[model samples]
Target: MSTIEDAAVWLAAADPDPIHARRWIGSARIILLPLGERWSAVKVSEHQGLAAAAALRGPSIHDPSGQCVYFLVAPHTVWDAPGSECLGESYWLTVPTPAVKEPPGPYWLRAPDGSGQLVDAEELRAQLGARSVSAAGAASVKQP
Candidate 1:
């Protein structure tokens, strides 16, 4: 975040549920942006008031939990700048965090010729669980 207050503003504006906000906003940023665009995110610390924003660099690789993981090349810098640094944290919201009971956002799959098709959330949950889809909008996952 640019200013300390900006972080607060972001937190305030996000969904009331912290976990939901993280998943929804985070997923939105991941799926909507260009396949390889990187971004900075100030991860709000549940234990504390604030922590430095991580690079949140992505379209990288998906984490084991099916959440896409990125490097927080540096901290305190939320503005997007090429080659910036951010802080990466694996202890998101502290472990044992509740799995998002709701769908993060709409999931899209790419077709053979390069077309994006929207898919249902249930379909997404199954595919993600199976790790069957390689890349979003990259290929279909058995067309079911």
Candidate 2:
């Protein structure tokens, strides 16, 4: 099965409250919260279009100590599958808010038609030009 299919199966089985599942279908950044090993809360960025780019270039969210964050980037169409149920047709970047203790496994970056790529946290961060923060208050960018 394709990665998207696997993600769909996981979403259906893992996410109990589908209604609250956070998603964005446009040019925006989203902060996600994990539901067990799955994503639960998706907080979309207020910035859109060019504004979204500016936000990404800006400072990282002030997270508490020892938190790890992950990001996933994809086009909006990937959620159009029968069960995906997403709305919109723009580029999207998804991240985990409040961060996770360890790195999140690979996530799906789907297109509007349900085709996409499976990328891990480090790759996503590199693509976004984001810097990884250490517990000791140091930050460094990981080149792809």
Candidate 3:
């Protein structure tokens, strides 16, 4: 619905600490998984994972190089408190290394939980690291 850049600017000013992350996941390149609606939980699966979010809003690749630095920041479409404080959800963001091999398509970025372990959102937690955060106005239930 909106450009990725616009989302970035909004995210940048998200919280007291808005800078999502920078990553070098595995051998895959990763980027932001843009979604019009806030996500409740994200994981590293195909059917039920962050990849689904990627399907909603993605192809947000900055580069396809694993040799260089790439940002895997969380989408910053959140509700902010004063002083640019984020009071909302964002998955685990990272700065994925460039892809050793060229990424196939948006699919790579869509790999759930950043399959290939290449990407993550900004603030939220990884399924493996800590508990995942769920979006508001949604079910209280969670998934792996």
Candidate 4:
């Protein structure tokens, strides 16, 4: 098999139910961390999200309905940020399968390229904080 396909298969090993109808589903193999007890997510708008993903140069997921992007981090990762969502153990994030890279549904903005690469929690927190500060500054500026 090709490298990407092999990587996809390797990544999919995290699937709790590989046989399930939906190729995409919740995975427990890697912990999503950032400002939480265990799993946390930093949601960013479409444009900013894309930029952040590019800046990080790591795996990220895009949710069309939510109009945001998510960067999956390592199990041991952690960060403290205001808007971050702390997901409990029961919370199962629906992720796209190896083949589902693009979206009509939740899809990978930056799929794992078989390097076992994930977003760094510290880097993500910094990006979010910087964006938040910039947004606040813009909002507080007086209209001419």
Candidate 5:
């Protein structure tokens, strides 16, 4: 429902740690799976094993090229004390990436509020989606 820019602002206001700034600024390859008549996006990590686990659990197709949409995430963190920090709220800024290829089915983006948006393949294509890069390359591609 909100634009990626909006998500960025929200992330910035939430977590302002400079160390995580680099990883949090770019787009993430989200794997989307077909659900009944719509598609739902799956959140994955940089770890291939973890991604595979997520794919298996979601029963979603895992594309070797992990490309999907760009999202700015303000990692969930908690402050144990004044100078100590732990993990807190999880928030992400989701935006469509036109330079990548659209998945076979519709894709969804979940807002920080927990609501989801369903986008059709055609609409994704019209945006000129980008190609996603797989973390493990050809060797990591799996069929499930």
Candidate 6:
């Protein structure tokens, strides 16, 4: 199977309606992590979120509202970034099939790439902190 197909299968394993039909695309699933808790996510503002994802070079999902982004992180990560919220157990994420790459709805900014890659929580925290400081400094500057 191709990489994306593999990713599709991997992700679809979480579908609660598995017995109804094996959907490969054109639908989304409300899922916990597959493979005994494989990942978690951090939700942040699109501004800093995209920048952090670019810096970290990891997969992220851009929310339909375009105001926020969800950065996928390794399972059991302790994420306490000031401006971001960690999504874990008891939290369900709506994930579109691997084939959906753009919106009207949530889609990948950086797609999974079939590598099972996830962002490092510490690096994401640092990047967000630096950006927040920069933004705060810019906002506080008085007009000359």
lDDT top scorer: 6
Best-matching candidate per TM-score = 6
lDDT of 3 by residue, 1-144 (tens): 233334333333322334542221322344443332232223332322332333343222322232211223333433322212222253333322333223443323432232212234443223322222333324565665
The ten-residue window of minimal lDDT in model 5 covers 77-86
Scored by Cα lDDT, where does model 2 land? 0.28
Off by over 4 Å in 2: 1-7, 17-36, 39-118, 130-144
Q: What would the TM-scores of all predictions be?
A: 0.17, 0.25, 0.24, 0.72, 0.21, 0.82
Cα RMSD for predicted model 5: 15.6
Per-residue lDDT of model 2, residues 25-122, tens digit only:
11222333333233221222322112222334211221223222222233232321111122223323243222222234312222111232322323
Q: Select the stronger candidate by TM-score from 1 and 5.
A: 5
Give the alpha-carbon lDDT of every model.
0.26, 0.28, 0.31, 0.62, 0.30, 0.72
Of 3 and 6, the candidate ranking higher by TM-score: 6
Look at candidate 2 and tell me the lDDT of residue 14.
Answer: 29
Ranking by TM-score: 6, 4, 2, 3, 5, 1
Give candidate 1 regions above 4 Å deviation. 1-62, 80-144
Q: How many backbone clashes does every candidate have?
A: 9, 4, 27, 0, 13, 0
Q: Go through the candidates in order and give the C-alpha RMSD of each one to the true structure.
A: 18.2, 15.6, 13.7, 5.3, 15.6, 3.0
Off by over 4 Å in 4: 17-48, 86-88
**Span of ten consecutive residues with least summed lDDT in model 4:** 28-37
Error of 1 at 43 (Å): 9.1
The digit string of per-residue lDDT tens for model 4 on 1-144 reads 665565556465554543442243234222222222323345667766776687786678888888888777765354467766434344456656555677678877777676666678788877877888898999999998
Candidate 6's displacement at residue 41, Å, is 0.8
- How does candidate 3 fare on TM-score? 0.24
Q: What lDDT score is found at residue 99 in candidate 3?
A: 35
Candidate 6 per-residue C-alpha lDDT over 1-144 given as tens digits, one digit per residue, 9 for 90 to 100: 786776666565545554332453434432334322667888998888878777887778888675899888877788778878888766777665666678877877777766677777888898999999999999999998
